[model samples]
Target: MRTSTTMPPLQALRAFEAVGRLLSFRRAGEELLITQSAVSHHIKQLEEMLGVRLFIRKAKSIELTPEGAAYLERTVEAFRIIAGATSEMRRQTARQRVRVSVLPSFAANWLVSRLADFMLKHPEIEVELEPTLRLEDFASDYADLAIRFGTGRWEGVRAEWLMNEEMSPVVSPALYDDGTRFAEPKELLLQTLLESWNPVGWELWLGEVGVDIRRARVLQLTDYNIVLQAALNGQGVAIGRMHMVRDHLAAGRLLQPFPQIVRSEKIAYWLVMPQNRRLRPGAEAFASWLKEEAASPPSPVC
Candidate 1:
């Protein structure tokens, strides 16, 4: 006789669950990838453990007894809960795949440029980039990780400081080759100030340079990419986030107008992940690689 504290074997529980559902030990064996004898053994053991006749056996069929019906109901419900939890965990840790939620501007200007190298190095792992302005809730069934640009005050997530933000003015070299020229900080008033939807704005930068924020003429653009495009085309001088424009600056597509650079007071880049859930193996690999990439100096523009 089994004690109240003692639980039946897992094999017996599985066999009972299947046999009670299908009403046939033979059919249950087939579903469980075992022989009919093994299924019978498990059922006999399970019935003896509980000291109850769980099934009524006929010559050609079997049916659950009243006691078995009640037990099976509870067993099936327990199985359902177990299966659901297992599925949710597996979905997050899907094999060899890492999904990331990031801002469109960062994805296009920063990540896209360096993604190819990661792919070449880790062909076995796959990375999916989901670009959106919305912040990710890692507890949800969405991205495995997130790249956030902020002061890292978000709740219920772990934020690793990724990089610092540098602010400076960038313009096309053509802008100065006889077109629009700014000799000093005060001369920028003569040019159309290209602005973007960013945490740090031209007004803040202007104030730092001793220029009256109200006196600055601004042309608002939709996003940072557009702002850079307008500056590259000599449309106006745009504030450059150094990490985003490093490649462009190195390639001579854009040039910094001033020697002074200011680090943002309240914002920078961070790698975010769930505080409670463990990262998938693939996500762990990607995260380690990403940290290494962030720590190392960036490659020179070719």
Candidate 2:
């Protein structure tokens, strides 16, 4: 009997797949949760094993070689099949657990509350929620489905809308109490704090209200959720995503003071998976459950 030494490492295959799909090692690193150097090293070891060039590196970007491109397509399919089969096997035993990745704010404010309903409906299947801002490669990251917010244009992935998020201005009770007059959107520029995640937000909001921002008191923030917290603490008025702020608004922690607004460019939350990937039993169950959840409220965009 002879032992074979021909099998490839899964790590190398994963690195190659991620980089080939994204066409950039830097981006692949973000998805894989590894450094760029680590990505390169994995690809290097893989190339050494196969004795072939996998990627053509340019000054600013990377392009997959013909072999790498062909390999990734098949490898991605392999992962999907494996994930699907494993989930199916677990489902037969009535002990299936699904992994769902979503943004932090959504996990805390929206999905966590609704999860109980899903569990009650499908008691056998357990859902594990992972909060992340970075999108994961389902194959490598072992996530069953990803609830992501974007324009829904990921290459090689299928996306279904979960909900549309509308935007409005929200402020703490103190801001209103301090007599900061936001009689008009323009007046907001004079006295209110423009808490921003991406700088374009204020611009977009101002454009919606037909105000050109010459200058404003701006507090640059990294996360929109943080801005929301700051607003709740009476720090400033932050632009709020309507769905996430619904509870706060209802509870009087935050108030929508004006009707003048911008429709968010941040349109929809989508459940995304690779188009070629075969969804596992858990993944399929979770997707269906999410669809049901999205439909129950009958949100216009879901």
Candidate 3:
């Protein structure tokens, strides 16, 4: 029989794991719904039981000692295995769910519209969508998969190429009506330019066409979706991402005024998953579906 003296306290181990993962006793306490003093006491007791120092205290912050880092890796993996087993047992008795983390703009303009089809096809699997600008940690239970806009390179994850990013000037039909054409790129300097989080698209395109952006009237917005909305309202011209605006352009809701298309060198969409981690069946299905969807041809430009 296992004796109490031979086994480390589960509470202390839990506290230590949380502190090691977050590198802050206060944060661990907050997450565990305990007091900072309690968290420190648990860590101290854990270190004493293990006969090793686990953290290096600093003036403002703390860091895991070398021994703590090694122990953390094993502890985290153990927790992951336990969580996986629990999830598997639950899945065996209930519908499987896949948690997907995605960028807000992509979720709003691209993925959400097609989700109904996925749902119809895979009735056994449920999907939870988490849309945020912040990246998800695959090591945690944050998400099963992530759709990220990047260069297909992230540490500890396998990034499958989704699609290349292309941008061009788009305007509402009202702005393009009356047979009004700006023959010269410089003529656009007189029109309102809608700006998103990063105004690099407009800067790049204007520079490529030798147009000075200093003369252009700019309306800055917080999100790409909002910028597109403004453009749809005929308020200004927006640098539209091809993938996001293809349907709108095809439907005559938006029009590409300029023929020049700019390709982004540093950014593209990617399907990301944890490296060497076995994906749940639900996640695998979603990934396969996403690949098929990406391979399909775009809507014809109207």
Candidate 1 lDDT by residue in tens digits, 1-302: 56454888889999999999999999999999999999999999999889999999999999999999999999999999999999988776654778999877789888887888888887768999998767798757689999988788789898888877778888999887866666889998888888776536576678789998577678887677888899998888898888789889999999887888888645578889988888877788888888887788866645
Scored by CA lDDT, what does every candidate get?
0.85, 0.78, 0.86
Candidate 1: count the clashes.
0
Stretch of 10 with least lDDT, candidate 1: 196-205
Cα RMSDs of all predictions? 7.4, 19.1, 15.5
Model 2 C-alpha lDDT per residue in residues 68-160, reported as the tens digit of each score: 788888989998999999988865988688888788878887789988888887788888888887776766757778888767778767888
Ranking by TM-score: 1, 2, 3
Give one digit per residue, the lDDT tens place, for model 3 in 1-302: 56488667878889989999888989999999999999999989988888999999999999988999999898889889989999988867688899999988899999999999999999888999998766676877779999988667678788899887788888898876755577878878878899776687788788888888877888888778889899999888888888999889888899887789888765579998988888888899999999898888877676
> lDDT order of candidates, best first?
3, 1, 2
TM-score against truth, every candidate: 0.67, 0.64, 0.63
What TM-score would candidate 2 get against the native?
0.64
Task: Supply every candidate's count of residue pairs whose N, Cα or C atoms clash at under 3 angstroms.
Answer: 0, 0, 0
The candidate with the higher TM-score, 1 or 3, is 1
Which predicted model would earn the best lDDT? 3
Error of 2 at 71 (Å): 45
Residue 212, candidate 3: Cα error in Å is: 4.3
